[model samples]
Target: MKPTIVFDLDGTLALGDGPISAYARAIATRIGDDSFGERATVALIAHAAGETSYRDGYHAVATLAAEDRVSAEIVSAAYDDSRALLGTAGATVSPPEGLSGFLHGIVEHASLVLATNAPDAGVTALLEEWAIIDLFDAMHFQVGKPAGLVPILTAALARGRVLSVGDIHEFDLAPAAELGADTALVGPAAARLEVPATMRGRTIADIYERISGWATSAPHTAS
Candidate 1:
């Protein structure tokens, strides 16, 4: 069986600050605070310093919005709206450089899966727009991670070796690591966090060549 490679959509494959900034705007509008952007930046700094448990800038804004007494219902609405705006001028998003070519290059060697906590709001459109939609063998959205990732990894493990790639350690890599899958950590968090991952990169592009190596070198005998 071909090896399985599970990816986190938002921060991993999806690059650029546009979409997340839109999320900040949504939160700010809901919470009646124009300072959310600044606060979210500070929260991200604190996260890098280990002073906060927020996973990323998005998490920071969500937590701060909740702390500002915004209802969970409102927060959910804001998030949904933000995602719906993805790829638009309000929430522009892009894939890493040469992402389409890379995925195509590795298709014969590995099975690609997209697993993200985000709803399907605009993900499909974005992938289709990028012209990489057909590259994936499966795309699973709203995949509540960490715990929710257990079953995805379990099934992949039964087939062959698995590689999970994403930005957040706790939400993306931790569960996959626990299940004995290799992991590739991505984004700025890669600079500070000591995670249990087989590979680390400040951006997915940083490890693309290495990932190509892993994909091509697969023994295809793990199962």
Candidate 2:
């Protein structure tokens, strides 16, 4: 069987200029707290993104803004509102250029799966918008990373080799690494995490190129 490549949706396959910071701003706006500025919001999000649960990130934000009476419920509401806004308004989020072609290049040699912390509807919408939904063989949403990766990794490993790719090292790559799967960390911040990875790059395109090169050079064997 071909190796199964598991991808994270938010920052890996989905390329964006500053969606995380933008999301932070939205949360701050919804909370109506002046103290939760974009910088602070970004910091909180970044910290949470590294954790096992997405809620941990939200809780951290609320705790950091306790002076403003920010609660987990409030943070949850803000996050929902931000996602709605991004989905309806077609915010700046988008897939990388030539995404379809990139996927096509590897589809024949590998099995593709999408695993994300985002809601299924939201991820589906984004992938549909990008016209690349068909490229994936399966998808698992709201899988709390670094912890919830077991089931997904177990399933993927049953098929063949596994390669997990994502932007955040701790949330996206660490669990896969622990499960003995190859990992590709795609962003500068990934370097901050002490996890071992098979590849590290600034963008999904870089990962694609590397995988493509490997596929081309790898030795072929009869089934």
- For residues 113-147, write the lDDT of model 2, one tens digit per residue: 99888766466777787778898999988888778
Q: Report the C-alpha displacement of residue 183, candidate 2, in angstroms.
A: 0.6
Candidate 2 weakest lDDT stretch, 10 residues = 214-223
lDDT of 1 by residue, 1-223 (tens): 8899999987789886677777877878877888976777677667645566567768877888877787888888888888889889998878888888888888888999999998898888899998889989998888888888899999999999899999899989889978888889887778777655788887788888878878878422221
On lDDT, the candidate that comes out on top is 1
**Model 2 misses residue 190 by how many Å?**
3.6
Q: In model 2, what are the clashing residue pairs, if there are any?
A: none
TM-score of each: 0.90, 0.79
Candidate number of the best TM-score: 1
| Total clashes in model 1, counting residue pairs 3 or more apart in sequence or in different chains | 0
